[model samples]
Target chain A: MHYWRDGILALPTTSHYLQLVILWSIPINFLTKSYEFMLSAKKIIKCLDDHWPVLETLVGRSTLGSFSFQDVQALIQRHSPGFSSEQVFREAQRLLHHEVLIPLAKSSQLELNRAVLEFIQFLTQEHQLGTVGDIQSRIEDLDRLRGKLKAAADTKDVSEMRRFIRLMDERVREVVKHFRKNESAIMHLVEKAKADDTKLSLAKRYSAVMEAFDEYIEPVLQMIDINAPFQHSMQALEHQLSELILNIEQTGFLQSEKEPLVQLRTRLLDMNQIGREALIRSTDVLMPLREELRKNTLISRNASALLAHLRKKGLEPTLEQLVPKFSSDHQKFSLGSANQITSYMAELVDFQDEAYQMPEQVDPGDNANIRVPDLAEVLKSARVQKANTDLSKWLAKSYPQLPVDELLFLYQELSRAPTLKLQHLEQYSTLEVNGYRLTLHPFVPTATSGT
Target chain B: MQIELEQLTQLAEIHKKLSTGYHVSEQDFALWQELDTNEEAYSALFTALGNQLKRDSRGYFHFDVDDATVNMGKISRLFALTTYALVEFFADQGQDPLRALFEVEISHEILASILQQQYHLFEQLEVFSATDLKREVMNRMLRYGFAKAQGEHFKLLSPVYRYLDALMAVDQLAEFPGESSTSSFTSNQEQADV
Candidate 1:
């Protein structure tokens, strides 16, 4: 009893105790929350805790996120030195239940949750980018609140007005906070992209750019009417507030309404201006991304087309004419640099030699022994042959009983003969040319010329 | 019915994009908002030029295709085939084609993998290399504003709804009745512009 009494007496006053409680509460609250999260996520955490060495192995591995259960067990055993299969199964089940680890559908693979992986990825990032989605809902919320405020004003409910005012103020503050945070995020993304030059592949690097455009910029732009849905919404709120002020002045009731209405109006104006600037800032950030996309896409498209040319005409012809090359690999050039002309000089002599290789010098002596027939002599011989006998008779004599292919070849040759003025006679004769039935055509007299 | 053509301030820009079949989206907010504000004048001006103003339910404006670009050669068929094949590929991979198209970073490797499955469909396109296919076909789609390229990746844009319609058509063919083919989402999504 004496000791208890002394303990109480030694304790500080009620206020001092309260101060101490307040002083320690922050860290205590944080610790408790962390503990709660750790507890909830314990199944996964316990698995890691039991096999703490596995973390080092995982961190060491470059390729991550997908591994078989057996592979996981191997990693676990290698790290923990005496890990059992039973323990592996138990811990895996626990992690799976907590959703800290996911078993890939239709496979024996497991992966960490996207959030955890992204957190690790964020750590690797020198510059970080953020997306703004929450604020869009905040703006929508403010619009909804304005409706309630208008209704409350009509009813002349003091409590309702106060509640609506407080709620609206909170919403506006949230929106402003969102705007600031998202602006910081954009700055981070841009800096990260700059820092990450060449470290990431082209696709991996521009993935963030695509995400910014598709996920953030496009959607936000869709939300804002600038002059329509938003403008109308602003005008309606302003009109309602002004009329409320007028009513308050008329009835001399709800004196508190004046300040809140003015504050709301000011906030609305700020939001209107902020929305535009937010979009402008987005555009400023995206301008570089956009330029990079355009340049890379342009270079890829042109290279593809040129490669197709290379495939068709072979390398030499394609290489002969110098195409414009983008030195995109060297420096991270802005959009302005895209149009900036750069000069490149290739050795024209080498390309010229390739393009116009001199025709092989055929020694005139190589073909001297081979007598080439004159065009007039060839024509006269064909005239003499045709005058002597028609095509079928000549075919029967010179190339009798030839195969179908040779017969067709002779037919083609006879058709092109200069002096063979042949005409198709319907069922004139059935001749067996090379064991194939032939519909022979009789000669037609041309200007009393006999053939 | 005659009015001064210059009354439509964005006439030249509108005409150029419309001629190329580029959908004028509200996301192109500045010019589109201007167009929206002056809808009456712009419509009239377009009508005077013998082009009908078309408003897509998906927050875009364009000229109705009275003049078929008439360039529907093997290349066009290849483009149409590739679009359909990709939608099928994503659907097979247990992904919603529409969402996947916008979300995924479509690199050369991915393109090659998907194309290998639809080899028969693209036999005539002569898409021997993934790079060539991207440059010749996918890049052309970019030119028509069906998608935008970021590095080697392409994120599809809203105008891809036109392709979505193509995809739906292919599904309707496969399903035949077109009743089971219709999801409640199709009608719901057709509501209005952003």
Candidate 2:
């Protein structure tokens, strides 16, 4: 049978000989169709293996929309770089023919087959968080199947009981599968959110985490709660399956049915055990992150709000009363200590005064020969100068014996002379007089005050 | 009240640190363990010394005071502004502000940017530049047991919740003006003014 399937699958599309043989043999119809399905499945597995890079890229980018055939062809060419346009086109057609990539509705755009996409995501550990309703409905289906199984068992309808057992087994496996997938998906979300290079904004980064908590973790937690309907229903289903198994064990008439009953019972119990463990592990991984995000949001919000207040009301007023205070006795810059105080007190206590020392009088004869300049004589010298004459320069040249202060004193008196008109210069003039370089606003006579 | 002399070996050191407004946290090994082990004894000892010893559940010990000195008040205000500015700055960059504030070792470059961006706010605290900020706020934070320096970088200690508490208090005050907000501190913390 395998060789016949391979021979037909390997035949070229235009081979009329095989078609004629298949048409002539009516009994081989079902066999041929099943072979074709197996062939198609094998082709898809091979296509996925050969072009996984392209499919992975498509899965990542096409989270929402379908990709055009040309886009797939381009991805093929990009994946191999050396492939010709014809080769890329052939690869794309093979992907579609094998049903590895399927058309979306009647549109020409193609998408990864839903089943294959999920399989690949499972392999990659990049699962979308399934809703609580998904698992809840499965569990509800299991409950309904248990009732049917019990009825079939009561009547000793072995075929009906077997059918319900198969259905219940599938449902139990599905619930366990959902639990594991959702748990892994949440783990993925946390890792992506915590990754340092995630360029998403904080809100965007944590949105998936928040959604997982609200949509998956929170509702699932309620469902699997110890006293919740989920737990009770699971327990009821376990009890029913076990009762059926017990009934089969007691009745030797249905000895052939005992194995399937035992298998289904074990599966139901395993599902419950695995589901609880998965939820616990997921919650453990996620609880701290949820708490950290909550605290982070609170801190950032309060900080920003307080900052705005501080900006508007000013810092001192906004925070003055709120700031935690401490004792002020440990002054960092205090200059006085007990030792200094004691020293001051000691100095005050040792009260004594030395006898007043009178200094010896200096000789008076050194100043007697150098006569002091009379202000009247300097005034007479100034009145004879040209208009706008610099009083400082003239004084320095005429009375080089006088000290700078004494010269300045004469200049002050001459400027105030009632008999001579003089003008003060706004601009300064420098003079080397009496060992001093003085930059002063020299008193130059006004143009009108010239003699 | 009774006293246990043998159990209070870190009394003098604890008194010195707490008296100076330095929070004794887990980082202060022997002293923190001393306080943790014999809290009642230490509390009575400090109470007899005329100090209100505060044990914040957030993990630290401090000497609670009704009012701060003028200088300490100024320093505390600077701390408040710097912390708020850091939060805003980290949030703007999409980093978790609380984690960044506590976990990350803030470099001088980050400090400089925060100071530059919040120039108007820091000016009120007399923090004119990054160096001034390090000296007036960050370094002073070290002395007050609010942060620890790691070479050239620094990370805030848990007692920084004092400012975080103050941050919330400012909001509460705005919402409800008549009631005083003492969310974190053990004492009233509201003594009107320095």
Q: Which has the greatest DockQ?
A: 2
* Candidate 2 clashing pairs, residues 3+ apart or interchain: none
Q: Where does model 2 exceed 4 Å of error?
A: A1-39, A196-201, A294-451, B1-194
Model 2, range A288-387, lDDT digits (tens) per residue? 4565533345666566556545544566766788777765554423545333355567677987998998998888654456678777766766666552
Instruction: Give all candidates' CA lDDT scores.
Output: 0.53, 0.70
lDDT of 1 by residue, A137-198 (tens): 67677789889988887788889988988887667655544453354345444433433324
Give candidates' CA RMSD values in order.
Answer: 31.1, 29.1
lDDT of 2 by residue, B1-194 (tens): 77978778888888888878899888888889999999999898877655679999999999877656687788877887888878866765667887888988988998997886566578776677899888878888898889999999998999998888777665453332111111101111110110
Superposed Cα deviation of residue B77, candidate 1 (Å) = 60
Report the C-alpha displacement of residue A444, candidate 2, in angstroms.
99
**Candidate 2 local distance difference test against the native:** 0.70
Q: What TM value does the first chain of each candidate achieve?
A: 0.39, 0.55
